[model samples]
Target chain A: MDGHGGRERQLFELGRLVKAGLTQPLGLMRPGGVGRILAVRSGEGDVERGLLEMGFVEGACVEVLHHGFLGRDPLAVRINQAMTVALRRGEANAVLVGPLLNRATDVEPTTDQESRPS
Target chain B: MTAGTLAAEGFRPARIALVGPPNSGKTTLFNTLTGGRQKTANYPGVTVERKSGLLKTPGGHPVEVLDLPGSYSLRARSPDEAITRDVVLGRQARETLPDALVCVTDATNLGQHLRLLLELRQLGRPLILVLNMMDIAQKRGCQISTEALSRQLGIPVVTTVAMRKHGVRDLLGQIDALLNQAPAGDGVTAISDWVEPSPDAIRAHHREVERLLQEAVVREGAPEHLTRQLDRVLLHPVAGPLILLALLFLMFQAVFSWAEAPMDWIDGGMAGLQQWLSAHMEESLLKSLLVDGIVAGVGGVVIFLPQILILFLFILLLEDSGYMTRAAFLMDRLMSAVGLNGRAFIPLLSSFACAIPGIMAARTIAHPLDRLVTILIAPLMTCSARLPVYVLLIAAFVPATTVWGGIGLQGLVMFGLYATGIVGALAVAGVLRLTLLRGDRQPLLMELPSYKWPNPANVLLGLWERAKIFMRRIGTIILSVLVILWFLSTFPAAPEGATEPAIYYSFAGLIGRTLEPLLAPIGFNWQIAIALVPGLAAREVAVAALGTVYALSGDEGAVTEALTTTLAQSWTLATALSLLAWYVFAPQCLATLAAVRRETNSWRWAAFMFVYLMTLAYLAAFVTYRVALALGGG
Candidate 1:
């Protein structure tokens, strides 16, 4: 959805891990870092389905918002800005990701709003 | 399709069910629809709650609405989900199939919520898709084309902010029309034709929802702005835990300090009633029973209500504000280290208030092993019932002086007891996870709901319901048990006034004497033995039993004043500390045991819990007594 079509997709795939070496597990993303989910590295269980059912589908945007204190075991990831999911680093390891297509959030200073409900 | 046409036709659905994914605001919507009229009980043979309430449409047509447990799909995984599935599929014998289904979805998370809607659609019931939390979605600048989405799904859909308490006018009319038109939804019960969706089917459904989302929903603005900003600090590594600790410390301190005045009022009121009764009536058995048994016994238990409310107030606020999940997030590492799911934190924390609700809350934990482990250790969480016992013993034995600047020594002991409960639970959970019920740890996959100011109405309503439940327990169970206790201790009065209290010759006295030898190793006398017997009815009842026992023995003062002095004068410091240690591990509450039984769906687990807890209690008391005696406190 970066407004580029198959040509750009092909170019990115060609560069793959070299240019987009940032690709890693969602659990390893730094705070405020953005990533596009490629797939969940599922094993033998419903973890894959559970994550998918929670909207970790392909091409979904995810950002690591916060990490737990000790060893940063559990990380809170904002999925597509629609839902915030808290999963431990082990479970979050299932989510494979690469650099986001859109770098708007990085370029544009974040907007703030006083939306706190009383 | 208007409300008038449905009313004119006298067509009203007999029952309606609210179905949704977890955290879809389904319960809030149910509250909006049913108002304050609701009954919550267990489904047959399961721990899942069956909440039904009566609601009338704008056209004045009555409908029975059920608030089902939130589920991701009809293919049930947990007991809670099983109930939702069975009831919807007309497989639950105790519950008839809902006449029409109200499928609720969170508009903000339509990308995910719609997948469940798509699955529910396959069931072929008359469904009205409700997009709840529309206000939040709108605030986040999500543009959802309701008409297009409705047309695409071939179902009626409406947007609602259920928290607003509005009639959800669009939904009200839609329900009226759908129910009127599809009066025979019951006849569409074709359970066998529905096969459980494989993972591939789930993926296909997800694709379908993605397609629908692309076509009908447009996203804009900095998504989840407030939540992201708040989490930056609240979920920070160091400061987050410190804040959680501070909040918990403040909550416990408030439970003692804030409740003092109210507890005093109730104590004085009960004492006044007892005094008045004694002054007016003759010195007869009937008069004695009225004052000592009823007033003193019930007053001892009721005095702790303020403390219970204070504890629950903090819990309710944290729950409604959605910080509880974050706490679980932070605690997940430690929990998993001790072999528990992060979701166990909610139930375990609530266990400090009472174990019954804690055990019931475990149903939300999908893994049976995690849920069982959570339930088994729930009673060790120093519930509010134990507060009266701890407070009474501390006030009588421990100094009331402050430990540091404004930190009370007594409050420190109370905090220590709470800490002890948590440690005990964690240790036991570790051992259980390793020894019996060993399995792969449940993954941490909980939704961290957006931070919002807790809805005051919901918080207050929840507090009131708990308060009512507490008072009902006192009014019925404690009152009746005390009456029976009084009779047992009063009848067969000491023969020929053998120079001791009349209770010494009573049936209760004989039983206490018989059990004294068994408890003697732990420094428990006959009176403590007698109290421990009836205390099994409820932990708080032990406080009442102590009050009733000594008050009947003669010249013992009233509950709040007299029982403290009486126990202080008689029990050695070793015995007092030993008793406190006993309560910390004792599974004295029958209600908690019954809850564990029902939740585990077996007497075996309950019996195991009882045996382990009793063993721990006895060992704890023995060690405390010996150590205190060796230290010359005895």
Candidate 2:
């Protein structure tokens, strides 16, 4: 797909997931996004390869720690309790993710989403 | 792989490679095992640091330990990783295939490290798994069964703290046992057995690592939360940058303020020694050489050693405490705007002290373009070597009047010089990145390791290494240039009693007079021309050269004080300002060029650096001089 079309398709898929409890592209998640990676999409060179080697694979939990001070173009993320990796938002877009697992309750919410639990 | 095959070959030291992911205490373990007996070289054509050390086993068998660059897997991306993979697989022509591999795994982050170990295991080398940072893991309430881990992986497992003295004895003992068992100089499998791991193969390797961890490693819960809490504040968008700025300010302040006493002592000592030598030794070439040549020139550069150490102390501490990566994270956005990597921050910062270590430090930056761009721009930072020239010029010309908030004008101008360096570096990096280094978007998938108290031993070792490297430069490059400058200033017997001091008739004087016309537009006199020649050895040597030139020209009093006053009285304000501008943009040191050559593995880049910097220096000085002259300062 073309860039804009692919983005639209991802958003559509994210909407479908919100309705029917499934994974979505990580780029669709908001700033405080936290979820387990479904899969890392192919393309790009060192960034993709480095992410894979850093354990950003299927079933690995990822959390967007924070964004850059200015443009917020790059984001810091923690992967699988192993490491915190910083990447551009465009680079983070490759990792497809599922919904965040509710920690205390061990439940996956299927409906309305919140940025963080109070 | 049989032990019986190696027993007949006699006691050739067994070669062992220490491999691990970055920040996994691999280096600390290497230091612990090797003590102070480590040597660093480059891996053939690549600039990746090849570190090796000698160790004697309990059985008196000598072992050669090589610390390969920290890497995640054999699927190499960066030059560093490729060197590691090549060395491990015996594909490197200059390196021997290791008799054994010591896979250093961070106990706190085994899930990420075990994959590398599993991949190494497939190579069929004798492997000893080192569970480094075990103390941290235990403190976090994680339990690991070494026996079970060993049984599962079919390799000996050893736990090590790596920082404390006794922490690595068990590891050493285990390594000795493995060595004795393997016999001496047993050859490993051929490089042809290595396969390019497919995505599926890597995924399977990850799965196998997960399975191994599940069977042997246990924890009460998930990862520690302390780091996350700390990051909430330390990595905060606004607070993070502020803290970094504050830390940098504090570091610069310490470098200048704390080094004053020691600098004074060194100055006084050198002057006293020079005076005593002049009094005792009858007027001869040896006395002149000892006093003016050695003491004045080398002593000038050596006095800044304390300041260099102070700067490196902070850098080493930040690196050891795991905050360097977070600093990189904080810097990524700003760096990426200039088409550089976040990892380039530390090396560029190190350039403020000196460019050699800074260029060496650039090895940590993975991308060749980013690393080269960083190396090219590193010399642009206002290194401590330039501090002397800046201080001397500012003191001579810029006023000491205090401005807003009691900040002295001299201090403000010094800060401006440093700021100019930053601006120049940024501008050059922007242009170079656009034109020369243009390529794919430089990715920064940097791993910010967990924060820990900076280990004192590791910090000391790092500082010691820095100190040794600095002193080595002083002894070789600075010393040679100083001797040559002394000879240039002294030769031809002063034309047999020619008035206007001895140097006026010497070869150096002639060269200076000839160069004076080219430099005159920038307001530089023949003496300034003389200083600029030797100044190429090092930026600070300009101060020393100026001192020697004035002394040879029959100026009275101590070199520094007399030179400052003489410069203020003799040269136009335009000249001083122009010289300051020159130092700011010039490739102030030939050592920096040599470092650039070594790091980039090409004299072409070094030549390009020299030409570009010289051009920038000339243009900047011309502009500054013309503006100052036009403003009626001449």
Candidate 3:
């Protein structure tokens, strides 16, 4: 799948669909690719501050640490160090991200590939 | 020393900490258990404070009941929960480990409330489960078998209706029985195993608890009646906000209208007492000190007690009715847009009555940064203390011109001042979030409790507690500051040939004169400058200080009348507006500063807060003064 689009593919569309907790997306692996933080959506004012204070800022580095059962919200992420924080799916959905950097073999194939335009 | 060490020291009383979710009736339980016989004071050493009271067990032995901040679980999230965890685990430095734990859980919400119970059970303490709000549960057609729950949990279970004092005797009996049992030793059971266990383990525990609950609990549908009808209108998107605004307007009007008579009585009483003291006693400095220094100064602030009490009564009623959480929910969306979390609404709302408790209440927010941000901005909300100054200024200067039919111009101005504070807080929070505490927004996940009629007793007790605290401040801190201010405005008798009063030669006059240049940009005269010094103790103290300073500045016979007339004659509307603006943001209360220090546990943050707030106040006042002056007001 590497450069299969012959240099015409968008950088934002390169992440694999891995089964992980939706709520805690920060620690979930984007095996073989790096992702960019797109936006944060939260209903509460303080929660946004909390996410930012905890280093879940826009344009910050985030990597998946572990996945919980059935790809729910509890995903661990490595923002800077090996340290991880568990977030719920409701909270994780508020954080929008783009494609990850570099692909890994251990990652599952993207399930939403059909939805992505070539 | 660790809390465990403190517990081991053996000098401290055996501590019994009450932990529960908010709206679980923990405070009502605390009040019922302690009654008015107990001493209610802040926790020693730290500001993440606990309310401790004395409770006598059925066996007639005394036990210290420490009402810890209400929390949903043992998970150390907010400062309030952190305090509960530390105190329970014997980890907090200044607090001792609770010898016994009373977990108050609302019966109506058993599944959710049980999580905390389970967490507390794993702590291996001698824990007792108090099923609070049983009356509400019964009203909702909920049935709980206490015996079955006790058997399931292997702990004593007591049902209590704290508001009406129902089942309290039985609950006390259970506490006595537990206290007689041997204390648990040093082995602390790990709670992580329960929550982060293997999938099978988690499933098994869940199944077991479910089965236990199935057998022990029976609940019908929630009652649908007046509360639902009220909430329908109160929680409407448009009507809710309108009602809130209307309620607030009425509350302010009540604070002014209802308090006027008592205030007059207090004022008259103080004047008569002062006169009597001066007449009966021999002419001595001590006599002058007693009447002029103590009576005149403190009395001025004490007269405002009725207003403060009335304001607090409304707040307590609102809180007790369980409508506060709904208001928070309604406000969350608006607050989030302005960089404040929804949880900030309660604390800020509470600040309208007094910033001290409002700042203290910030512990409920789960995020530290969010709580700190709320605490830092709370003082800007224009507490009840500022009302007297605002009222005095408005009554003296602002013409009584109605805007629309039946809408008092004075009330409109009061509303405008409050709106200004709210706007200022939002602006500051937004700036701080963008520049300093820049971070992602946290999601607001708060439980909205079913509404209930506020227990009259609890409301009365809350009002009484606030009234007492206000009185104590007036008696001690305000009293002391007033005496000092009086002395400063007195002494240094005027020269024999001088036409001016003795106060002109006093230290306050000299100090005020020196401060004139610094305050001139804000259009404050020397007397106002002198008043601002004592105002640092409390915002309302400025009003009293003004009364005393002006009283001592001239003839005593017509002080109050002369002072009001002098203010009207000397001060312009722009000056009043500028001063009001200054107070809207000024970090004036020592109590609030002390609380911030206690909450943050760092002097750096406190100092930073002081400097930033003072700068804001000065700049705001200066701008207002200049703008008003350009408009030809002063």
Predicted model with the maximum DockQ = 1
Worst 10 residues of 2 chain B by lDDT: B1-10
Q: Could you tell me the lDDT of residue B579 within candidate 3?
A: 91
Local distance difference test scores for all models: 0.80, 0.80, 0.68
Q: What is the lDDT of residue B233 in candidate 2?
A: 87
Q: Which structure among the candidates has the greatest TM-score?
A: 2
Docking class of 1: acceptable
Candidate 3 structure, TM-score to reference? 0.77
- Ranking according to TM-score, highest score first: 2, 1, 3
Cα lDDT of model 1 by residue, B415-482, tens digit: 78878888989999999999998998777778888788887777887788778867876787678877
Ranking by DockQ: 1, 2, 3
lDDT of 1 at B411: 79
Q: Which residue pairs clash within candidate 1?
A: none
TM-score of chain A of each: 0.70, 0.61, 0.51
Residue B28 error for model 3, in Å?
2.5
lDDT, residue B230, model 1: 80
Model 2 ranges off by over 4 Å = A1-24, A101-118, B1-10, B41-47, B165-167, B183-190, B220-222, B551-557
